[model samples]
Target: MALNTIIINTTTTTTTNNNNNKEDKELNSITHFFCAMKQQSPRRRRAALTTFFNTMPYTIDESQVLVMSSLWSMAMTNPTNPELPFSGALHCMSLLINKSLSQPSWLLLHQNIYIPYYAAHIIGSYTIKSSSLAELAVDAGAVPLLLELLRGRLSWVEQRVAARALGHLASYDSTFHAVALHGEEVINLAMKISTSCLKTVYTEFILSEDRKKYHCDLLTRGLGGKEMEDRKAEEWASQLQCWSLYLLSCFAFKDKGCHYLICRELGFLRELCRMWGGMVNGESPAGVGLMRILCRSSVGREAMAGCPEVVLSLCNLSRSSDDWQYMGIDCLVLLLKDLKTRIKVMNMALDCLVDLVELKNLGTRYNVGSTITKALLMDYHDHDKINSVVYRLWELKVERKRREGMMVEEELVKRWSLGEAKKKEGNERFYSGEIEEALLLYTQALELCPLKRRKERMIMYSNRAQCCLLLQDADKAVSDATRALCLSSPANSHCKSLWRRSQAYDMKGMAKESLMDCIMFVNLLVGENREKKKRKVIKVPYYAARMINKQMNAVGLFAGVVTGEGINMQTIEEEEEEGRRRRRWIKEG
Candidate 1:
């Protein structure tokens, strides 16, 4: 189904230490309120959050909110560029949502704010008042995108946010009927994550009202008279926080929420098996056992004790690659942490590690071994398996690390010996007047040295370049000099190497190539933003370097913006809800 894009007139700003100003400080002050609420319990957190929203600082301005909204939009769409402002906005949402079991309500709030925003973002641009003031997301292609996200638990943050957003859509209508992506393809692709096939509480919500949040800067605050995208983002975020906290409430208090989740969302676990594709055992038609138990449990638990099955299931597909295994592991880890469900998924990780070792893929074994080692070290007080698995994990990790360290040490020793021999050979070749042979020997020696000897390598690279120049190997000469320039640490060494290479390339009738290399030398390594004229015979090309400066600057800015969004968007729901409530009341009045 197509979702309507709601263009809000909200405003916000973030302060990067490097980009600090008066405005940044004030914006941070406003966000600090949310940050403080992060420490509160579910009930107190909500109360504190509500109080904070009610007593919002009067100095808050519209332009600031607009900026923040633009930043968020940029981050979401700027997945490629990375500088887009809202890029790490999900992190903000996670902070608001991923609370302790004690704060289930706040967690629900966190879930709602980001999920709806994600749904809306997928909606694309909208038309309002016959004048498109801003672009709002639509739901034209969100299903496929969300399915893709579920295919691998950790493919893309944007996609993960979108998938989680589906749950919120289901909740928005207060029905919890739609088990999103409960279809065959989505289920089969997702290793651990599941979607329900039959009627669930969210099913009603998904198919219910299709109301568009029509936000305008000039309009009154309400459904149609929604606040500006920039202004109300934080408020809408607050509303989402409320919903997520509510959902989280389903998990705590020793209730049957866990088992009911599996049963109420009928065929969810089955779809998970189906989505696992090649990894599935294909036994018993995907959760025939789960079906009977879930049906029995959901019906029986509420009437009986009410405590749900707190344990979840996990898989370990040893034949799969790191990416594939990571998908499953991430889901398990997340479920364990967020759902307060203890699952016996560590067996899968152990199986994967054991298989990795058995396959004799040293690199992969080392990688998996390292991963389990970290897991073993993590605080395991909550998990029962850690008692049985920790020692084994430690034993394996020690063995792998020992072997790896030995291998590294042996390689270094071998390189050192080889380098010594090569250096001797180079001296002999140089004394014999065989410059080409001498250069080859030097190159061999340089390649054998450790990173600590990078300065020596730079010198050798320079000499090789000189030899190549004499031999009329302009390409080789340029390559050697360019590499040397890159490795050269001292200011004088870089200046000389870059100058030599630039001149040598020009002499070889390769001005364009030389220009490109010279440009890279300055911009990437030397960072030659300015130059002072001197009586030197040669100089690095300043114009070429200048040409790429904007691109690099843009990349740096985008990175900063993305990182900031990650930091600021932790409680996206709280911000959004706070905005929505104020707007709604104004509209009603």
Candidate 2:
């Protein structure tokens, strides 16, 4: 009977919590609807609040309040947490706080808002980290207010946050310049942090950290095996560390204005980035945003030099496990594109893309996954990228085709080539045609082909497929041909392979596909032939390339591209929607 009541009570608690969640959600929806109705207006917002208050009396769940409270408190401390903490009457108040800034709403005249009245800030120990609060704070000129609170050395965490909020205030050039000019004060604040116990309350492992350069890996040491509780804390530590580094980096750049400051910060940033190489805190986006800012800053010389280390570390994060690699890959790609970090970026990205089908995130993986997906598509537009993805796809296609026909082609050719004397010894062994060995040899030969008269990947797959067909692997033959079709038009591939795929399909009872490929490949090839025949070959004499123009004699050879550093480099500025990429490459002769 006791167990039954206990079970019943547990059930009731769950139901109540679910209802509260529903209430929170419904309240959120209604709030947003009214907000949209008001377009963030005062009266509609007030009406919305009136509705929330009207509904508030119907709700009461003290049992799991702390659970919800913990989440709310988390949202307060971490800016990246989703907007649940600001739900209902409280969030509405926060919104009202900011909305009143642009327009002196009557709420300000009244002074006491619902949020502070409820004492949510004191109740939950919430800070202004909640974005709503941050936005409102920024909107309300909280820069000076926050700076003042950061003055004395408080709990190490509080001092760090103060430093960060001050850092954020300088997000824009005007404010950044303002903050930068406040050098003595900022330096004084940093000096306090630099001197304090490096180790503070971060998830557990951070507690054990040296608070120095070689701090323990948050994921490895801190969490140990208790991932659930420790993961969030570890992530927050990474973000805070990154934010701290960013602010300091910028601070050093702005205030001390010396090489030593820049070098130390740059060195620290490289280490911090290394520490953060693979950790994911989907809840915190400042890391990605901070890195982007540094990349875009005038400190490119040092930042770019340190970029590869960042990529290498981030890639290590990726290769650690499949759980975070997807998001890591996305961030990795963006990190890769940052000026000089492409090589590591491309290789890892291509490797991951080839193996994974792209997955979604539940708790904190959404943005990073989307970021990676967009980059993959972006790479799809590049020739080398297309070549890579397509080639891998064709590889699978070839295997499928080979399985369909166990006979011989690319593999068979290799088998035959293996022994010139064997060919003379027995026509029976050759043609009794141990179809399996022949097929293997033919496919192997295709792989070893030095120069393709057509599309390389397709030709290889096609030869392998025919070997399969000879071995009566009909499905294998069709699969290879289909992949070849996708890899190249007839113009780009050898003719025999295309026709062979068509014939292989016909034998496999796929006559329609066979006929379609036959016609399509021929038409494409014909088109290419016509274009080539019409185009003139640029046969400029080698001497003409080296010849000096009389009009440019005073300007010397005038063959090199112009550069700011007096470099005669072949640097091209390719302006992309995201940013500019100026690559200096060897000029084609």
TM-score per model over all chains: 0.23, 0.32
Q: Candidate 1 at residue 588, lDDT?
A: 53
Report the lDDT of model 1 for residue 194.
26
Candidate 1, residues 505-548, lDDT tens digits: the string is: 56664333344345535553434433343333444356545533
Which candidate has the top score in TM-score? 2
Q: How many angstroms is residue 59 displaced in model 2 relative to the true structure, after the best TM-score fit?
A: 32
Please provide, for model 2 over 345-364, each residue's C-alpha lDDT reduced to its tens digit, 9 standing for 90 to 100. 56544554432222233235
Distance from true location, Cα of 99 in model 1, Å: 35
Off by over 4 Å in 2: 1-141, 148-152, 160-198, 202-239, 242-264, 277-282, 285-289, 306-308, 314-589
Best by lDDT: 2
